[model samples]
Structure formats: structure tokens, C-alpha cells
Target: MIKELLEAKETDSFDELCVRLGNFLGIGKAVPPKVLLRAIDDPPFADNLIVCRNTPGFLQSLFDDPKTAQYDGDAGKKKEDGKSNTELIAKAATAFLKWGKAGFSTVDEATLERRENACLACPNLSEPKNKLQKLVAVKLDKERVGRRTGDKTCKICGCNVARKIKLPGESCPDSHPAIEGMTRWNEPQRVAAAVAE
Candidate 1:
């Protein structure tokens, strides 16, 4: 489904496709599956919708060992470019989680420190207990946070889904630098995380 969406992105008529799908099925929601089904249930792309299954154990190691999950997809890129993937997630997480860490003046320093912390902590970054004290500590007036990450709502459960934040988008309170090679979870991860709740 995601791969198909990626293909749909390349089409000359994706705008029309999205519109047709939206019109036939629905528009935007918290997850993408519903919109996909809506596209399928209605006219146009429904019949042609393709589904691919995540191979069993394809990501088993990740689940078995989250330490590898946090591993940067592009370490060499970070070394050369001076940034790693998850820079945004780091920034947002830092912003969301900043408590008492210091030495963020340089990208190298922040990256090194955050990487070390994540490695040492090795906790699910999303867990409330693991969440930055700043985010939890701060008295936010807003109850449910409304974040903007491109994704769709689930059809099976009708729940909004989102992926984890990428580390590159993170910025140090002292120095806002790009984390290299990190990809912000487009939407699926966010949706997946939400569904876990």
C-alpha cells in the first residue's frame, strides 16, 4: 500500500487521483489505509489498488532489538555530511524531551551526546516514562497535541496513525543543526505508534 502510494506520487495525475480517491472514498484522515480503501471502494483506482505484506520477521530483529532500530540508516552520510538520520526526531524529541542535557552548541556535540544518550537509555523514545522530562514536565494547556505529519487514518480501526519523528528535524536549543540520513516517519509510523495506544 505504501509502495503503491509512493508510485501514485510519481503519476502525472496523482492530484486527480487523490481527488478521485477522495471523492469516491474520502479525503484526509489520521491514517492512509482508509483513504486508500475509499479510493478502492469508489471509482478509478480501487480495483487497481495493490497490497504488499510486510514479510514475517522482515523486521523481527528490530523488534527483538530496538538498539538496532535506533541505529542510523546512514552513518557514513553523517560522518561526511556531519549529520545522521533522526536529526529532526532528535530536535522534536529534544524539544519534547529536553530536561537537563547540556553541550548542544555544536552539531557534532549534540549528535554525539544524543546518540550516546539514546544508546545508553535504549528506551522506547515514545514511552511516557522515557519521554523528555521537558515535554512531560511542562504544563501544556493543550490536551491532545495536533502535529502535522503527512499520513492517513486507518480503515480497519478508523484510528489516526503516525510514525516516529525523524532525528534530522531536531534542533539543539543552542544549535539547530540537521541530523544526517535520518528520515522522519512520513505517517505510517506515527499511525502505528498511535494505534499502540
Candidate 2:
């Protein structure tokens, strides 16, 4: 679908592109033309669309539903994780630097198991369906972290669950969906202590 849209973008006028995108998203006329046009040029919007294409009716729910239009991709930003893609990237980079400075050490076995268990039960742990997601997973696979049977990518932070759980500096991005007031993995003590200072 993205390939087709990119091809169409070459020859289609702005209005034509808007119609094409609207039809593709199954939003019909719910989203305004200006919003649709913005979506066409929005990199994050395209990335989210591609990543979520496998989800049944997700695009329609995001683009067609009037209630979600304001917060979803219509504004060229989807804050599903309450963090932008750039922020997520920055967080990952910081984690990597911390891990490197700590001699590439991993968490204790118990901590790894706990984190892995949380991620295994998380709704955000998803299979890498798109090239971008698969690439990240492949890169992280080299870490050779002990992986469980159902290990997959965490959609919020774009990390491979199996590898991410082993990093001491890493923490869950959101609270557990079913567990009120509990983060999937509590913030690392080092980070929490720093924040308290």
C-alpha cells in the first residue's frame, strides 16, 4: 500500500494524493482534505501506518473515527505511547550508552526473568512485520540475549523484547495495561535516584 502511494505521489496532484490516501486509509471523508494531505508528507504518520497495517481495521479506527482523529495520525502525530518517535530514539540511545559504560553487563537472572515475563504478557509486544521493525530486531539479535519462545518487539520503544529485558539501564515505557499503578518494568534504580536528586 505504501509502495503504491509513493508511486502515485510522483504523478498525482496534492488533491489527488489526498483522495488516494483517504481511500487507502478507508477514512472516506471523515478526515479533512488538509489533514489527509499533511499525512502524505508526514514521515512518522507513514511509519505508523506501515507498522500498523497488519492490525485489522486499525487504520480506519485511527483515520475514520471522529473521536480519535484529533489525537491519532490526523494531526501527523500519534501519541499512542505518550512519547514521540524522536524521544523513543533518544531513550534507546541513552540506554545503549549506559550499557556500554557499564561494560556491557546485563541484569541479574531474576531481573531478566521478571522483565521478560512482563513483556511476554504485554499487548505492545508485537512481531516485526515491517522492514523497519525487522531491521531493528535483526540488529538487536546479535546481542545473543537469552530469548523466550514468544519474544518479540516492543512497539512503544521499538526494541526487541528478548534483548531489551537484559539491559540494566532499560525500563518499560508505560504502565502495565491490566496492573494499575504498576509499570511493566519499574524504572531502574539508577535513573530513579538521579531524578530524585
Candidate 3:
């Protein structure tokens, strides 16, 4: 059914296709899937939406993993990036000290999956964490359950792929240094616009 939705032609309305896809996925009516789909500017974004929707069953498998299910809270351990714990700690402390006026940033599921998929394909991304586990005050099962990662962190942004992508208006800053507003998720659209201009 999702595949059918993906196969929809340009003539097909994204809204109608999403309602059908959402129905098949059993996505609840609280937030219409069409609303989510509208955040997607293009088809690749739509493809990512289908791929990364975290169904309950999928989340269960992540929580079942021993390495991910429990929160070790070992922030000082040597990360795969080989930066010293002390150095990373200093960097974190500096950021914390400077942090101010943070606002909640939200994006529909489609945008996040699309950005994450881009990070997954980026060469600058070295070692990626298999999953994300964090402590939550509420202790709900779903909250405790870890979410799988497409990539752990971005070398360019010095932030985790999942976290960085979720920021309200962030773009990938790959090495080129002049990729202006180009993120891994929207490179094609950016290129098309550049060509047109």
C-alpha cells in the first residue's frame, strides 16, 4: 500500500496519497498524515517519510537490544571519533555555559527522516551510533525505548545526526564551504534552482 503511494504520479495529489498511505500504516488521526506530508518539499522527502516511520513493532526491537535498552550515562567514555574525553568534556561545558534562550524546534517526521538519510550517505560521517538512548523523567515504555540512528553525528556540525537534523531550520554544511542552503536532503532541489537561475 505504501509502495502504491510512492508510485503515485505527478498528477496525483500528495494529500490524497498520504491519507491512503497513512491509513495503511495505521497512523492515528490525532495528527493527519497529510499534514506531515505537506512539510515534504519533494518526492525523495516522501520516500524517506515511508522508510523511517517508527511503528510500535519497530521500536520494540530497538528496546529489546541490551546495549541500547539501558542508559549507561557514560558520557566520558572514549567515543568512536577518538577525541579525548577531557577535550570533549571541555567542549560540552563551553557550549553549556554559552547556551541561552533555546526555543523548541519541531519538524514533521518527513523532514527529519529525509535529513537523517542524507547524513547516512555523507562521507564526513565517520562512526555512527547504532541507537540513541536517553533517560526520561516520566519512565514510559516508549520514552525509555531507544530510537535507531541513520548516523550518530555529523563531523561538520559537531552534533548528532538525529539531533542536528531536528533543529527547526538547519542545513547540512558539507566541506565545500559554499553549498549555500544545501542540505543532503535537498541538494537536488537546490541544484535545480541553481540551474534555472
Candidate 4:
């Protein structure tokens, strides 16, 4: 029975699922693995076991751009190590899992509804609304257009580049010119114009 239940859920490795099921059933309280396994196999308890054992996921993906968020008052500057992102996501995922876990007990139907509501209400768990979703959405929309931007190298040095760069852009140094017209489209155009020598 445990075997079949394990097969049915298929969420993680069998060992991890077994640990989760054990944890759910209060196994450390003298519950033997075989006994717990048999109990889970019982057709009657299949749904219960599946619900208890499933791992909950994060509520929403993040807004990934570093630029706009730089000036946004809330959330402040994203840190260098990306710890801010991990911490924010960890909090949301933990709360969401907690909300789901509390649902399994005799916690009434209203309680479960409350968990769902609370998860939805959580700001971090909330769907990336407005500006947040726009970041990922625009990138995905570009991908769906079936063209690769091939934004891969420095036009000047022919070296692979992390970002678009030009000496005239104030991005180069303090004394560099402010390249107002330079855009991704200008990349090849400028390269062509320069290389004609």
C-alpha cells in the first residue's frame, strides 16, 4: 500500500517522500516505518496521506531587474550576494507551507479557507502584480516571439560581454561622454561604421 501511495504522489524521491510521510504521521512517537507504510497503503487514507505529504511551493516568482528597484523606495537596493532575494522567498515559502500543513488536522473547513486566504493576502506570497510581474512577463513575451537577441559580445574589443558597453557611454568612466543615442540596435551599426577602416 505504501509502495502504491508512494508511486501515486511521485512528488520527490522515494526516500524523501517516506521521510515526509513519517514526519506527517508522527512517526518518532513509536510508529514503525512498516506500520506507517501499511496505514498509508490503506485505500481509505490515500488522499489524506497525499495531502499531508505534498510539499508546498513558493507563492510567486520575483521581480528580477536590478535597475528600477534601485530607486524604488520599498525593498531598497538588492544586495550583492542576492541574499535579499533568497531571504524574501524563503519567508514566503515557509509561510505557505505552514498554512498548508495546518490544514491537515481537524482544523475545520473554515480554517483551511483562512489559510488559503492568508496565503493570498501575504504580500510576499502575493502574485507579482503590476511592476513585479512585468519584468518576467516582458522577457517571456520577447521569448515567445521566436527570436534570440544574441546579445553576446563587446562590439569594440570583440570580447564576450556581460552588458552592452561603449567608450562614449558615461557608464565607461567619469570622463567618458554621455552616449545618449546608443542602443542595442546601434551596436552593429556602430561596429560596421568603425570597422569599415
TM-scores of all predicted structures: 0.17, 0.40, 0.32, 0.18
- Give all candidate RMSDs, comma-separated: 20.7, 13.2, 18.5, 23.9
Clashing pairs in 2: none
Winner on TM-score between 2 and 4 is 2
lDDT of 4 at 68: 28
Give me the runs in candidate 3 sitting further than 4 Å from their true place.
Answer: 1-102, 128-146, 175-181, 187-197
Runs of candidate 2 with Cα error greater than 4 angstroms are 1-99, 136-145, 149-151, 177-181, 186-197
lDDT head-to-head 3 vs 4, winner: 3
Total clashing pairs for each candidate: 36, 0, 0, 0
Name the weakest run of 10 consecutive residues (lDDT summed) in model 3.
94-103
Give candidate 3's error at residue 36 in angstroms: 36
| Segments in model 1 whose C-alpha atoms lie over 4 Å from true places | 9-11, 17-197
Candidate 3, 144: how far from true, in Å?
A: 14
Which sequence of candidate numbers ranks them by TM-score, best first? 2, 3, 4, 1
| TM-score: model 3 vs. ground truth | 0.32
- Model 2, span 47-113: residue lDDT tens: 3443344453666443454433554443534443455544533432332233233323579988877
Can you write out model 4's per-residue Cα lDDT over 1-197, one digit (the tens) per residue? 23322232333433444354445443322222332233222211222233333232211111122332342333232322334534433432332243233333343344333333322232223222343232222121223221111223222332212111211221211111234434322221334433221
Candidate 2: worst 10 consecutive residues by lDDT?
Answer: 94-103
